[model samples]
Target: MDPYIRIEHLTRTYVRGTNEIHALNDVSVEIADGEFVALMGPSGSGKTTLLNIVAGIDHATSGAVSIGDQDVLAMSDARKAAWRTRNVGYVFQFYNLMPMLTAYENVELPLLVLPLTRAQRREHAQAALEAVSILTRRDHYPKQLSGGEQQRVAIARAIVTDAKVLVADEPTGNLDAESEQEIMTLLKRLNKELGKTMLMVTHDSAAAAFADRTIRLEKGRLNTKTPETAGA
Candidate 1:
């Protein structure tokens, strides 16, 4: 079967005065449907940059990215934005929840852009919250929820759009050990049971262990060792 996501020689660079910084250098990867992969690296390793490019939030300077059959790099800005809303769901380290919105409202926000009726959106949002086992807390505001609950709500929001690919950046960064485990279990469930492709960037070794495969980066380039070889 064709990979659900593909990156070919992806490179991203930023220029500050005369100095050029390479955020991603010839990074190529392929993720099959329902696979859960972890991106591991220290700061400035370009894991987040790769996620951003894959999510269509940032463009690579050179190379190509394809989500299923669509060439992401070739898409027009408007098309990319629209495609992202439909195909990609993003979970950030900071949660990025709307402060004023209740958990239900936060998850419902994404549906507003779609053609779904209010009742449909509500139904979907509630189901998403339930999937995370936080349906009862939907009425609470972000500030009122614990870190783990807020993260669960964030995950609910990400999936409420029915996105096929979930791109998470340091998703467990702010949570405690138990909460982190809960989040990881939820992510695994999404990949295994829900059939969503997940690409996660994380610094935690235990968290990375949850992935089926782990890719490490150094100086913006893919490391030579595959996870199996590294273990050997």
Candidate 2:
């Protein structure tokens, strides 16, 4: 079968003062429909850059990225934005929650751009919070929650749109050990049970152990030395 997500000859270069910096260099990879893959490497290895490109938040200097039937690189800016809103869920190292909004309100933010009714939005957001085990704190503001709880809210917000692909950048970086385990378990469950293809960038080997496989990068290039792994 064709890859559910395919990135071919991806290269990202940016001019920094008088020199050019290569963030990703001729990288190519394919992810299966429901596979959970972890990206690991030292700093400046292009893991986040690859995820950003895949999520449509940034364009590759030269390459092609296809998610399922859609050609991500081929879309116009507006079209790509719409597609990304509907298909990609992004989780960052820091929980990027609105300080003032309640958890439910934050989760509902993405739905505002869609055509859903308020009730529909409520249903989606509520389901997402419940999935992340944060439903009871739906009315709480970000500052009122613990770091783990806040991250849960962020995950809920990401999945509220029922996105097919989840791109997480160091999702457990800001949490304690126990919280990190909890979050990784939740992510594994989401991928296995809900069939969300996941691409997670994590420096923690223990965290990467939860994924079905691990891909490592070095100096913006694919390392070609990934170790076989299984979901915990």
lDDT of candidate 1 over 38-139, digit per residue (tens): 898889999999999999999899999998888998988998988898899999998999999999999999888889998999899999999999999989
User: What is candidate 2's lDDT per residue for 116-201, written digit by digit as tens?
Assistant: 99999999999999999999999999999999999999999888888999999999999999999999999999999999999999
Q: Give per-residue lDDT, candidate 2, residue 154.
A: 94
Name the runs in model 2 displaced over 4 angstroms: 226-231
Query: What TM-score goes with each of the models?
Result: 0.96, 0.97
- List the global CA lDDT of all models: 0.91, 0.93
Number of colliding residue pairs in each model: 0, 0
Which 10 consecutive residues of model 2 have the lowest summed lDDT? 223-232
Candidate 1: segments with Cα more than 4 A from true spot: 226-232
Question: What RMSD does model 1 have?
Answer: 1.8
Q: Which one wins on lDDT? A: 2
